[model samples]
Target chain A: MSRIHHLPLHVEFGDCDPAGIVWFPNFFRWFDAGSRRFFVACGVPTWKELEKTTGIIGTPLVDTQARFVRPASYGDEIVVETSIPEWRTKSFVMKHRILRGEELLCECNEVRVFAQRTGADPHAIRAVPIPEDIRALCG
Target chain B: MSRIHHLPLHVEFGDCDPAGIVWFPNFFRWFDAGSRRFFVACGVPTWKELEKTTGIIGTPLVDTQARFVRPASYGDEIVVETSIPEWRTKSFVMKHRILRGEELLCECNEVRVFAQRTGADPHAIRAVPIPEDIRALCG
Candidate 1:
């Protein structure tokens, strides 16, 4: 069974909009944090460490979908539950659920691939095959 | 015919991740900007104005999907093209395409609804029917 990870977040005033609700993009930021937390919970190496050992820069999203069920405001303490449901040859699907106590605030599903820097362009990234060792760690 | 709007943005250094690429979540921030700009380009009143005149606070997204094609970094300037492709009784679909010159960086489709405050809860919002004048303006 794949291990699921949970990351708790404290929403600050900067995370809210003029409407006094959390800005939508901030959820994505938390989701990305959840992704990293999932890997960490699985005892995976940090992306920076992997760059030296495996040439893997990081996992970057190719596609993503999100649904907002309710609005949250500043000072809200939320938890993001993250898990990797499927692993492909070069990609994986990561899912996140943001919640406040028992209330689900938002949910997201993302398709992401392990990436490597291409050539000398520091910004250019190319997808690489899923490393077996990393998969074993996550599993 | 529906009007399309474009919002230009400069990528700041803080918007980049440790990898020096634009963090994926920042695209959603630009998309929200494009959504507001679309209504502005259609000559609709600002959300603050509508709150008093029409009881509409703003358009809040219910669902969203995005595809990231190319990565962008700090110092890059991008433009987001926004348009409404479909309008329902209580919701509409907002589309945004982020581009660097002719290169498409990311694209998003969002299902959003006009919302207003509910009851005594300041942060609670409920969807309202599509306003006729607003529809006419967008169309």
Candidate 2:
């Protein structure tokens, strides 16, 4: 069975645009929040833990494709489902779906690659192999 | 001269993930902000003005594709350039590029469709012709 996790999110006022509908970009923010929760649920060290213990870097999204099917409004309670579809040596793909009851609101797929911090520029990133613990959980 | 407007953005701490680099998702936020400013520069109503005056609904992104060539860091000042590539009868396409000085960071293209609001629901969206005023300025 696939490791599936459910996350509940409250639409914040900042998440909406002047139209009173949740801005499309905020969907991604919710997705990232759910992803963090999924990692915690799986016993993987949270981002903070990884930073302190392993020096492991947070994965950076290389590509993302999302489709907004139904509109979500401010103050709506939404559920987000996240699952890993594929795990490779250095990169992995995650799929997320946001729903309101039976209504599908948004679907997204993201590709993230592990990287190591190097050089004087902290943002200077280079692709590295996934850590063993992450691979075990995601694989 | 090409009708392009450049807006400089400071990458905020909230814009970065635990990776210590600017999160890819935040790029869209910057794009939206830059586009809003660009429209204002072109004499188009600010997003707030449009929402109130014409009941002009905000455009919903139907599709978007972004390519990350280089990582942008928190606190980095980046420039976003926005331009209308094509204005269809009811929808339009906008192109955005993020640059750090002379180095290109990322580029994205988005398709937005005019959606009309109906009683708090946006299903009443129909492709309304681009207003001549917007076309003249954007063209």
Candidate 3:
């Protein structure tokens, strides 16, 4: 099992929609934050530093599935638990669960790849092989 | 087959990440706007109006899957095409495709429910049966 990283957050009023609940897209934002925090917890360098040293930009999401189990409102305290349960040659699966106390509010599984800029264009990026050293550090 | 609605959008600078690519979560936000536009195109009243008469607040996503195909950036003009492929007793499937000119950028399928406030608490919501009239309008 990989290490699980927990990121605590406080829901702000702006995070809620007119329905007085957190907008669905904001959950994705939190998940992305949790992913980066997980890498930091694993002792991986920031994507900017990695780009300079390894020519690797960052992990970019290719596919994702999310399930919303409960509604969350502004002023609520939440925590995101993130882990990588599987890793492949160029892609990895990141799982994130958002909880309010003991209750699960949402969960997501994202497939992302380590990408490197292929050309001068910023959008020109391609998935690169997972760096073995980084993988070891994460493990 | 349901009526397909298209919503045009212009990508803004703030929508991009440090990588100069559209942040993935913004795609979900556009998909949601496309969903509401789809209903309006079908001649269904806005959720707020519906709530006044039918107690239906809106369609809230329960499950969603998204696949990112190509990267897009600021200044790009995109369109979101939305349609409903299936409807169930208390939930329906909404499909959204994002395209930049002829190239597809991202696609998503979301399972959503018609909800009604169960109590004074905003978080207290429960799925309700699919409204026959609204379904007919969308079809």
Candidate 4:
């Protein structure tokens, strides 16, 4: 089986546009939520905990690319599969695919960077190296 | 003045996440709205009008790449700038920048293809040539 994690999502009315279909943009929110869940499952603390514990900051998206293949309507039961395909010194890449049963809805790839939040500015935060403890649990 | 078109946007509560900042995904919706307005200003009919007239469809996105530079909060009045950089027979490209005054919020480049819908299956839609009028106006 793939190392992918599955996240089941329900489309809310608010997720729809005037066209009565799930607005294309909402997939990104769902993708973000799924990533959070995956990180927690991998034994990393929640974003809040990470911020408090390591003084490390939340990962901000540096780049994102998506392709829409199908339209999803309101109330559709969708599945989001997420995985980390690449991890580097200062950033990591996540890939997501949204599907309705057998139908593919959209696919996205996102690159996120870690930064240290100073008083008023953010400084570049490097990976240094994944500590054995964290890497064992996370990777 | 720069050829940049400034479109003021309202940040709806639904646009925010639990962190109380606008989620990154909603920026695409705002970008689409700004692009629609730009097309209207260019004397190109709105997407709905084109759909009605030539059976020409709203080109579904094939790819989008975006970077989030800053966080925006709910109720913030932000401006989005959109410009068409390439107009082709089968696809067109646009670049967008979202800003809050002088602070840059996000930047995105999107590539979309003119597609023809087939039956009720959105995925079955096939990319076709850009309608003559649209090509002429955009060219």
The candidate that wins on TM-score is: 3
The alpha-carbon deviation from the true structure for residue B85 of candidate 4, after best TM-score superposition, in angstroms, is 0.7
Q: List clashing residue pairs in candidate 3.
A: none
User: Against the true structure, what is each candidate's TM-score?
Assistant: 0.97, 0.88, 0.98, 0.81
Whole-model alpha-carbon lDDT for candidate 4: 0.73
For B1-139, candidate 4 gives per-residue lDDT tens digits of 2245679888888887644567677888888887777767667876567657655456667778888777777778899988878766788788899988898889998887776656564334667887776665654
- Candidate 1 residue-wise lDDT at B26: 88
* Per-chain TM-score of candidate 3, chain B: 0.98
Best-to-worst TM-score order = 3, 1, 2, 4
Runs in model 4 deviating more than 4 A are A12-14, A18-20, A120-134, B1-3, B10-20, B74-77, B120-124
Count the clashes in each prediction: 0, 0, 0, 0
For candidate 4, what is the DockQ? 0.48
Using DockQ, give the best candidate's number: 3
Better of 1 and 2 by lDDT: 1
**Sort order, DockQ high to low:** 3, 1, 2, 4
| DockQ values, each candidate | 0.80, 0.56, 0.89, 0.48
After superposition, candidate 2 runs with Cα above 4 Å error: B51-53, B120-127
DockQ measured for candidate 2: 0.56
iRMSD in angstroms, per model: 1.1, 1.8, 0.7, 3.5
Give the best candidate by lDDT: 3
lDDT per residue for candidate 3 within B26-124, as digits (tens), equals: 999999999999999889998889989988888889999999998988999999999999999999999999999999999999999999998888899
Model 1 lDDT at residue B71: 92
Residue A56's lDDT within candidate 1 is 86
